[model samples]
Target chain A: MLLLSACGAREVVVQGNFPKPLMDPLPLTLGVIYTDEFAQHEIFDEAAGRAESDWLVKTGDAQVEFWNTLLNGMFQEVVQIKDSQTLEAYKNTVDAVIIPAVADLQYTIPLHTNIKIYEIWMKYRFKMVSLEDVHGNENGDLSIKPDQYFADWTLTAYGKTPTAFLQSDEEAVNLAAVVALRDAGANFATSFSRVPDIAAWMAEGLQPPPAEATDIQRLEND
Target chain B: MIRVIQGKLIAGLVLAMSILQGCVNATVDEMTFLEPTEGIGDASVVIIGRRHAPDYETEFDFIECIGDHIRRGDNSISVLHELDFINMMYPWFEPRTAPLRTDDIEKLLSQERVANRFEELKLEYMIWIDGSTIETNSSGSMTCGVGPGGAGCFGFGTWGNAADYEATIWDFTDEIEVGRISANTSGQSYMPAVVVPIPIIAPVQGTACDSLGDQLLKYLSAKM
Candidate 1:
């Protein structure tokens, strides 16, 4: 009975924890914005080199919220803005803005007589530019060009029985996509020092030391 | 009444001995598959057994026979043993059990020295064979020892052997799977010794090699 019971059952879950920043967090506030096409679900075709409308994923806001929370926990400060247009409003408040897009999202489910395999792949592209650069107010004609970064992730799972196979396949595909996006978000939080111009600007913008309180009598004597 | 009971006891003893007797024969089961590889002709391929087998060292001759069959089937395909390839490309490795990432392959290809070396060799594919043939079941045993006169064995024995192997093909240029062929051969054998001796052996490894080699040949052949 035990052997027969075990033949039809298996479970696997893969999730990566965000790593600590290698260097101290940059003393810079940042804004994040998603593209207008972000919410629209797209099927990326490798042969065609284009994306078409497919299954809709209504969790864009939730995903943005997750990144906002994760970045805030990792960095000095991060604010999730509505879109690119809204990024201009935070020019003076935040030091830089990041535009992220889901460039590719797809999965393949291979069927077998007694087993099933599901593989999910995702690619995310991020563009980062300082607020001053976006407003065309460069510091002494030295413009900071936007930096681009890409993260591609693939995840797979296997199932044995028909019912369990379908359920696990769906779960694996969805979880893989979500985890890939979140991982890219976490990576973005700790990658400021990689860009030379941003690193230099951050170094110059370090916060001032706090003033210590002094006793009233000592102050008067001084 | 005493005579009848003695007759019945002898009959029961003979039945038990007959039930426990061993004989010499073999049985086998096999499975094979082939997929089309459209343009993989004349590619350089090396076959090797994994270093870390469960109990026994992998029989290299079995794989050599497979390589021979593949060469005979396709004259254009270049085949080499793993040791020769390892000697040539001493520093680098083609990992087994996991797919190599394209980015990593690209990095190796991007280096000027490695790229030049790779251009010289133009090695593009690999076949990793892993698994073992083992004795699954055995019953009854024959014992023999040398005395002043000679050796002798007193009993009978039988055993079942199983050979399971999986061969994975990799395309280095694309960093993807060309195909996978798995072959399993299982059989049983027996040995009996009374005055003279008789032994039967199951060639599980040979059967696996032949079956897997044929599958690889058909799989790599271009689609019509």
Candidate 2:
């Protein structure tokens, strides 16, 4: 209800408080921003000796493929960060005005797998810092909520290592970005339109994919 | 007619599976082991030996060696999992202790091949690997002989250092562990092939650690 009211207020202001709310779509200022994947990334056990020579290319393709399967058309396109400066630009934009959510918020996970090795625990919330300029920040903010975004990583093998499991931390981050885009777009649309897919937009808020029920989880330290 | 062909194929597969049931089946038990807040050194870490693949027999030399070393020294030093499982009544090929206690067979059998580890030695919780480690056929340190490391495992030492073997452990955790280890053959170093003609390459020598068990007990004793 509160979000709906806020949406109503914002929509009114965007359209001069008139009511039709059919504003034209704007250009992307910051470009889609992703963190931690600044350099080469790996979603496999280094011990397995997987090559990263062409990792970014393969991963980018794989990520687009997964989102296309899960939520089509939610993004105009998926973009990767070219350099730290761009990332900084995106970050500045986000920090200047948009208050990203606290990912550090704790999540109490309950499980039935009786395995004591995996104790039920909580995760500290983490907040996303945008890596865009002020305009870029507006582009991301005007489009999506970072918290609702989902990312995923696919594993090369099924086993003990956290990356050994099916989806990896990097992949999870990518999934989050896609979901964020979906939510951001939905928020923008709902301000003017009354489409029902808002529920679908919200569904991406699911917890990090659990380690393969086969016992594979990441951050062994946590 | 097509249905009949499909049925025939299905029946053939079932018949073949009956003959090859052993090959067709594997029971997979899922596990989740979260790291303790405490780092490796503070606690006596227990790394349950995972069963690789195909090898039905259990190997005990490594565990025995660790236990002996842990027992011989510091209280903060002594390790609980070792040759205390050895059966003294009968002496055989390995000269070390038995891989597992015969009395514990029913307990062990009830569970699919598993390395149930009490990670922190903390009585409150335990952790088990939900991943697989490759089996090897080489050895290093004091008990340097070459054979199946475990089911599908290839014993390491035939070529690399203990750090090399760490690769197997790392493969199970995505760089969750980042330190390195180096050790020498411990307790009574004997030339691997003194009289035998085929020489081992890495010289199962002592510049590394002390005795095999003591060295392993000391080193592996502190991993994340």
Candidate 3:
């Protein structure tokens, strides 16, 4: 009877809040870049081996894809640059570059208990380097240095049976990854619209292009 | 002996109470607003999640339920779900350590891209939702193991769940906080036979959503 009383399921509470965008999001052309090696950001456990099965190795790809899907329409433009060469090609086209890496991903099922605790996290680095920084000025003089910005976000999820914990270890791990990546993508998408420094940079780059003669004439006619 | 009978009776009563507690429903602890709510007749308002919290299952369902209830009160007010809102304004603002201040709202309006959309949508208000439903406490346990045929769980247990939510209303036209509504609810569930877990608690999330939605409409009513 005493054991029965103690065996009650532990409360499963997954709590967090996503903030509303303070102001309208800035209209800036953004690029997402992934290095050759880091592109496959698979998670590993303490045993120095892959945390999940072979199927889960591509989880990192999903995160990057999610970021693009979210940011594509929200900003003026979002470009996906998979390698350094492509990043170089788009130097003049994009206003900023974002590199997201999976910082941590692990799922552990304790030896003594059926409960499984899974965790997933992502880290993002941002750099705003103008075309002038790389190609030099009209006079072929490299006058301005690249302005750099870095932001790191991590999300952890816990699953203990009867509520938070799911039925299988795989399921729990997948759930954690999905939740963590969702937040990471959300944070990355809105970073420039909220962060003071980044927002300023975005605003500076967001000056409206000179109106065309036809556009002006149409407006005047209206 | 009579004494023995009394001891059993007391134990039975305690068990009955514990089990019955799970069936109680949830309710709104308190909801408050500052300035009088303006009539939002025919304006489109959206309910969105806070950009910083961890999301769980049924998150959208929770928000949708509230939206449905709010719409039920005033059919004219178009309530946009979180997904629709996000689609309209993707790449939301960054996660804030704290809620946005007046200055933040101004900055947002300064962006032509965002401002134009708000104008196009005729968005009048935004309700920011933050909170979750979690298991708070539990007693008893169940054991499960895999056999040759399949895996199964055995044993009996009971647990408690608490649903807490806070909704803050932001008036876009005025660019100020109209009011704040919060719901803190508690409930419980029982597993008479380890396999089936039955929920019995007061003020469940459904109740909270409905109550909040109605209260919000009432507060926003021109009649109020």
Best by lDDT: 3
- Please give, for residues A43-84, the per-residue lDDT of candidate 1 as tens digits: 532222222212332435544555555556546777765533
Q: What lDDT tens digits, residue by residue, belong to model 3 across residues B30-121?
A: 44555445667677888875545434433566788888887777776778777766745544432322236544677667768778887888
The number of the candidate with the highest DockQ is 3
Ranking by DockQ: 3, 1, 2
TM-score of each: 0.39, 0.19, 0.58
Best-to-worst order by TM-score is 3, 1, 2
RMSD of each: 20.0, 25.8, 12.9
Per-residue error (Å), model 1, residue A40: 70
Query: What docking grade does candidate 1 earn?
Result: incorrect
Off by over 4 Å in 3: A1-34, A46-56, A63-118, A125-222, B1-22, B25-39, B51-58, B93-99, B141-156, B193-203, B221-224
True contacts kept of 1: 0.00
Clashes, model 3: 30
True contacts kept of each: 0.00, 0.00, 0.24
lDDT (C-alpha, whole model) for all candidates: 0.53, 0.27, 0.56
CA deviation > 4 Å runs, candidate 1 = A1-222, B1-41, B52-59, B94-104, B145-151, B222-224
